[model samples]
Target: MSADEDRDATAATPPELETDRELVAIVAVADNGVIGKDGDMPWHIPADLEHFKETTMDHPVIMGRVTYEGILETLGEPLPGRTTVVLTSRNLETPEGAVVAHGLADALEAAETAAREHHDGADRVFVAGGATVYEQLLPAVDRLIVTEVHREPEGDTFFPDWDRETWTETARDEREGFTFAEYVRS
Candidate 1:
């Protein structure tokens, strides 16, 4: 299928109005694309953690329901000035210091609106999530900032695979045990 066809098909596959908005997925994965295991990440690198925060701060971080819960438990609070957008089927009783969106399209729309309302131009929106959310948000992303961790851990949850040819590396940094790589869509 063509790009238009792919977008249309993806929009139709899910049962909601498609949102026309840009998004990005920021993640640190292993060489094998393994992200998490047993509902939590298995690695502990201060540099990786700092990179994640530094990249995602001042923007909206879109996530799936489970990812939202995991992030809430893991990160504890919203990153100072950023808005956390949780996409779920359930209508949340409270916002949990974050915004709640109904679906993938809705989540993108929410991010866009939040950016416009808060900032001057279209701001960065990071879909920091589980597999499903990443897959859904991948097509609309402007960049995919991937921190390629050195060791591959056994993971039940993995990052979606993409053609390396489709991305251009913007920056790269290496540490003792891991490497950080940023990819902008080409």
Candidate 2:
């Protein structure tokens, strides 16, 4: 091809990736929509937790203040090997490593920056939620990595209601009591 043809090809954007950078939400939701009970996951599935860790390994993970606190209770620190961004409307003290955002816009902005600068220029940012955060960020989520638990457990918190038709299932892995599902917007 000619020089002009080469230049044109180089300038053209790839069609496969829908966005320059995607915002991803990762969560485990039971069949009845329960995600948590009193700030903690109602069901303890070690495999699901491992799935969460591997999928979000080097990305920036965003969550609500309460969710961050809940994580602190369990792990005693912000999640390791990833940037932690906490979104809250109130004045709260987080550990040294966590980034705090006062609103959704700030949270998203922080998440993107962290993904680029901190995680070896990652192309995706992750949202780890506590129901409210999930609800607020659903519209902007480009992809979802969900662990769909087969059984319904009692809980006070629930995952947000999302329109399934808007998403196309890209992959699925069936585990013993749960299925790891991935979806991208259609």
Candidate 3:
């Protein structure tokens, strides 16, 4: 199937959209496609951290179990001021203030609902990632707020390769360690 046909088929398979929420993938990827080493981020750029916090601050963040676990390990809780929807098939007890979802549809639903009630009418669901989540949701993402890290560090997990033709770069900012870039699906 062509891109349009494939997209059309998957677009309708969903969490029963009661509202249209922009699905945004928020990530920092190294030049060699590394996004993570083990369960933590490969690099520690404070600016990128701040950037991530600012961009996804008021929106519901949807991430896979591993990603959420990484946050828990480092911060002892979910990021403050955002509803976290943890998507996983396995049963695991989540900490307070975190929403657990067993599937993609449930994850999106939880994010959408949280965005409606908690974020004061925010309409974007940011997809935080551990690789698999980003890979699975790439096709559906409306926009990408990517921090393009300059170094190529070795890593076990990698961000999925996306076609540049599918997105149009809307903005770019050169930072100390990385270039912050935004792309909208075209």
Candidate 4:
């Protein structure tokens, strides 16, 4: 189907729409498309970390189970200033101060509800991911806040390939180790 036809089909069963809400995907991908290795981020770019924090702060962040566990292991808690919604199928217990959903749609719904309640009118739900979560949500993402790492890093995990033609870069900033680019669906 054409893009408009695909969009029309999606619009038939839309998720609950808040007055001014958007679903944004936030990611940092190396030049070779790697986002993780051995269940963790392959690179250590402090500036990118800070950028991630600032961009997603005060919004609900939806991530996969592995990403949630990785954050807990590395940072010692769910991200501070954001409601975390973890997508998992193992029936594992939800982390303290986090919500769990079995699928992406449920997770997004949960995140939206959390944003409404805790963030006080914040309307962005950030898909802060592992590869699977990113791939699954790519089609529905309204905006992308991507940090494009300069080097190609070898890794087992990769960001899903997306159609560049569907998005238009609206902002860019050059940092030391990476370039941050923001894209809105065109």
Instruction: Encode model 2's per-residue lDDT on 1-186: one tens digit a residue.
Output: 111332221122223212346878899999999999988999889988888898889888989988999989989999999889998877877776589998777777787788778888898888899887777667667888999999989999998877787789999999898999999888
lDDT by residue (66-181, candidate 1, tens digit) is 87777767767655567778888898753544888876666777787877776444557788978877776666666777878889789988887676777789888878878777
Global lDDT of each candidate: 0.72, 0.81, 0.83, 0.81
Against the correct fold, how does model 4 do in TM-score?
A: 0.88
What lDDT does model 4 reach?
0.81
* Residue 46, candidate 2: alpha-carbon lDDT: 90
Over 6-28, each residue of candidate 4 has an lDDT whose tens digit, in order, gives 33211222443232468888999
Candidate ranking under TM-score, highest first, comes to 3, 4, 2, 1
lDDT of 4 at 163: 72
Model 1 segments more than 4 A misplaced: 1-22, 119-122
- For candidate 3, the 10 contiguous residues with the lowest summed lDDT are 1-10
Q: How far in Å is the alpha carbon of 85 misplaced in model 2?
A: 0.6
lDDT of 2 at 110: 82
Output the number of the TM-score-best candidate. 3
lDDT of 3 by residue, 53-80 (tens): 9999978998999989889989999989
